[model samples]
Target: MDYERARAEQKLQLQELENIRLEAYKNSRLYKEKVTAVHDKNIKRREFQPGDLIFLYNSRMRLMPGKLRSRWDGLYRIERVEPYGVFHLSHPSSSELIKVNGIRLKLFHSEKMARNQELEIFLLEDPTTADD
Candidate 1:
């Protein structure tokens, strides 16, 4: 009977559609794996050591109204460096130690300046000294 033949053909088509759906799912997983590999390869490792001077990001600073205010609020010293980018920081004036991620810290660089001077800048309106 033609009806029997049509039913058999429909069953074969349904089986083929199921196989196609499984193959699509497999390809999606493969694509995600490749993307993850590429992302992991491009990440730069951060390293820190004890006694290093660094600034820490203050997450709460963004809540303030000052648009130009600095969000980084640390002159913290690295007291200890732990596994997986964790750092223990100590402020010179504070006895308490805080643990933070290395991603929240950046190395602090500075040059020694004269004691009575205002941080390496000359007042344009001020009278010049005899040494000038």
Candidate 2:
């Protein structure tokens, strides 16, 4: 009788351990699924096309000496779209096209274009006319 009781207790303990392990596995799978769903939703799949003008972040663009330091430069024209969102850009200063990642580029809006145009016009205007 004593031996039978000991064996029964051992079986119950083993069953409990198995249950705990299964629960842990289920929880881990649930967490992974939730994380994957959120990541998929946040991914930007839209690709930039040829002829689209974008602003290259200063940190990403190669700097040249004696040039005005700008946080955002190059109304870069997209020459080609490569795999994995990489782009071929025609940088005005470089005059040579270069490949860059899409994350480093931001699409330019019409409002920004208007503002830059106004600034260019003001800079080019005669100073004598302003005093008149």
For residues 2-56, write the lDDT of model 1, one tens digit per residue. Answer: 9999999999999999999999999999999999999999998767779878899
Candidate 1 stretches with Cα past 4 Å from truth are 109-132
Total clashes for model 2:
0
Clashing pairs in 1: none
Question: Model 2 over residues 15-98: C-alpha lDDT tens digits?
Answer: 999999999999999999999999999997756789988988877335554344456776899999888878999976777888
Clash count, one per candidate: 0, 0
The true-versus-predicted C-alpha distance at residue 83 of model 1, in Å, is 2.8
Top candidate, metric lDDT: 1
Task: Quantify how close model 2 is to the true structure by its C-alpha RMSD in Å.
Answer: 7.4
**Model 2 segments beyond 4 Å from truth?**
1-4, 60-71, 111-132
- Report the lDDT of model 2 for residue 122: 29
Please list the C-alpha lDDT of all candidates, in the order they appear: 0.86, 0.81
- Candidate 2: minimum summed lDDT over ten consecutive residues — where? 118-127
What lDDT does candidate 1 reach at residue 16?
100
Name every residue pair that clashes in candidate 2: none
